[model samples]
Target: LPATLFSATVQTPWAGIVAQSPLVLVLTGAMWITYAAIYFLATSVFKRTPQDAAVLSLTVALPNYAALGLPILGSVLGEGASTSLSVAVSIACGSVLMTPFCLLILEREKARAAGENSGSTLAMLPVLMWRSVKKPIVWGPLLGVVLSAIGIKMPDLLLASIKPLGLAATAAALLNT
Candidate 1:
């Protein structure tokens, strides 16, 4: 499956999609995660009667921040703001890809137990897009890139503020890890 996508990307040769805006990549990831989470919540978390599912979900999901993410960022982005942003974006994307699938399996087990067929989407779609649009962090990177690309550098102070907050979040994650 991954190979196929890689091949398609190669064939396309127009996928200038090299992490244009950290926000777009981040949002796409988050959108994926929430979609997965809601799927699990509706199908597994809500339906399942097992406490172990929570533990299983935790065990199967969250990655080691200080370990895997740091090395990847260091290797790819080096030790700088760009590295920090890249690592943060990559970690965010990777989690969205993996966590939801695990939760889906968990949810499917739950839906089965609850005697339900596949989950329903009657009340899910609109709200999901709304949530996606409302998220600023997800759009921030994209917006920043767009604004920058158009010869607009936000005030230095604002950029400075964003950087510190980003670093703080990363440090906090490392501590939690």
Candidate 2:
């Protein structure tokens, strides 16, 4: 949908999101809780086979940041909208932010599939969380968020310089990809 229409629909709540800290944290927490439940249930409850479970888990677990997320937020939040920028930071928190967690799960599943003991069995989750927390994708967006929250306005000259560069870069990346 177009940004204008999306703005007309979501502007009130989106504005409130940007306006407060506790609300933001609550929303973020709710999102993660939802994701965890979906991922766990996708793997545990619904799958008839291991591969089915893996695929299910991955599908629910993966964030299609570059696809559904970025464009949708960009459209909804409109040009130069801070909330859009905020969502941009999150959407760009792509698999890089998540690969380690994926890897850790895959490791345990592989061990179980191979009928080998993972020794302590409990180390898996902490390791996965640690890896995810330490990842660059997780932290990079946080830095962007901090800058944005501080109202760091880009200068006209800087923005002008970056705009075409962004367009060209996107076109090039799309073509190459």
Which candidate tops TM-score? 2
Predicted candidate 2, C-alpha RMSD: 8.1
Query: Relative to the unseen true structure, what is the Cα RMSD of model 1?
Result: 10.8
TM-score of each: 0.41, 0.46
lDDT of each: 0.44, 0.47
lDDT of 1 by residue, 40-68 (tens): 77447567533354434444444443235
Q: Which ten residues in a row have the lowest lDDT in candidate 1?
A: 4-13
The C-alpha stretches of model 1 lying farther than 4 A from their native spots are: 1-72, 75-77, 80-123, 145-152
- How well does candidate 1 score on lDDT at residue 105? 45
* Poorly placed runs, candidate 2 (over 4 Å): 1-24, 48-58, 61-63, 92-100, 113-116, 124-177
> How displaced is residue 175 in candidate 1, in Å?
1.6
Q: State which candidate has the highest lDDT.
A: 2
Q: TM-score of the candidate numbered 2? A: 0.46
Task: Give the per-residue lDDT of model 2 (tens digit) for 59-143.
Answer: 5655444334445566777655565544453342323234444555665666677776456558556754565556544444443
